[model samples]
Target: MDNSQKRILMAKTGLDGHWRGPTIVARALRDAGFEVIMIGMASTDDIVSAAVDEDVDLVGLNVGGHIDVAIRAIEQVQVARPGLPIFAGGTIPPHAAKQLEALGVEVYPPGSQLVDIVDAAERLTGTR
Candidate 1:
């Protein structure tokens, strides 16, 4: 598929209001030629609804709360759209990252490179 044809849905699963991380990631994805739809400060229901309704090829989640919060969104999104690849970044701890990885969601904690995140988006969206 063409790189520009891929669409990504980005949402912040918590009410943190810290937009720097997701904003940077979204910009990077857009720079790489992927269409990015950002839904800031969303709940599990909102995330699932947008993921399905937007027909996005990939979901990028910004988790700024307890692992359970992100997990809830992940589980619901998986049920709503199985096989829809997800990648996440934010202030996630190591244990939480492991949990997300176990659920097949790629996790990028603080200090992660933008290039790597963009590459993951491309791969997850099948635009690589």
Candidate 2:
């Protein structure tokens, strides 16, 4: 597959500046041949706008805030782009992961493997 054919929009949904996780994941995705757009510290509106404007195939959120905040952003993304698959990763607790999962957002908390995430992107984006 051509590496440039796949596009993913990555964002940080809170004030957290810890970029290690997202950075590593983004690199893995990019190296795997997916175009990744990283938007650090973005609000719900910003995330939505980028997802739409960029015409990305998937949305990845690095959540580091109250679950409600992440939920709000997820909800907004759903409303704005229904069926636009979204996945999240960060310091989310087990319960928070469950909540995100319930809302149809795939959650990959700390310690998740990069290969796993990249595989998920492929599956989610129908590239696999």
Candidate 3:
């Protein structure tokens, strides 16, 4: 698939207003030619709704709160849109990353390189 044809839905699962991490990732994905739809500070319901409504090929989540918050959103998204590839980054500890990985989400904790993130997006969307 062409990069422009791949849509990625990005959302923050908590109330945290820190935008630097997600903003950078979104820009990188967009620069890499993917259409990125960023829904900032969304609830679990909002995330699931956007993933379906936007018809995104992949979901990228920025989890800044407790791991359970992100986990809840991930579970809901999976139930609502099974097989929709989901990846996450932001303030995640080792244990949280492991939990997300177990749920099939590609985890990129803080300090993850932009190139790696873009690469993951390409692979997840099959645009590589």
Candidate 4:
């Protein structure tokens, strides 16, 4: 698939309001030719609505709060769009990472490389 045809919805799943990580990843995705839509500090409803309304190929969540909050968003997204290719990144600890992984959400915790994220997006979105 052409990079230009790929779209990703990049979202922050907490009120933490930290942008350094998500912004960097979003930039990398954009630079790689994916149209990235960013919705900062979004709740489950916010994330789901954007994913549906935007009709993006993938959902990237930047989680920086209680895992339950992020989990809510993840579950809602999955319910809204099964197999929608949801991935996450942030200060997620090993336990939280395991939780997300069990939910089928690819977790990219701190220190994750931007290239890896874009590559994951490609693979998850079936554009690789």
Per-residue lDDT value at 85 in model 4? 88
Candidate-wise lDDT, in order: 0.92, 0.92, 0.94, 0.90
lDDT-better candidate, 3 vs 4: 3
Q: List the residue pairs that clash in candidate 1.
A: none
**lDDT, candidate 4, 26-53, per-residue tens:** 8899899999998888878999999999
Candidate No. with top lDDT: 3
Q: Choose 3 or 4, whichever is better by TM-score.
A: 3
lDDT, candidate 2, residue 38? Answer: 90
Give TM-scores for every candidate, taking all chains together and pairing residue i with residue i.
Answer: 0.98, 0.96, 0.98, 0.97
lDDT of 2 by residue, 1-128 (tens): 56569889999999979899899999999899999999899999999999999988899999988999989998998998889999999999999999999999999999888889989999999887
Error of 2 at 70 (Å): 0.7
By lDDT, the better pick of 1 and 4 is: 1
What TM-score number comes out for model 4? Answer: 0.97
The better-scoring model by lDDT among 2 and 4 is: 2
Model 1 error, position 69 (Å):
0.5
Off by over 4 Å in 4: none
Please, what are the lDDT tens digits per residue for candidate 1 over residues 5-117?
99999999898898999999999989999999998999899999999999999999999998999999999999999999999999999999999999999999999999999
Output the lDDT of residue 127, model 2: 80
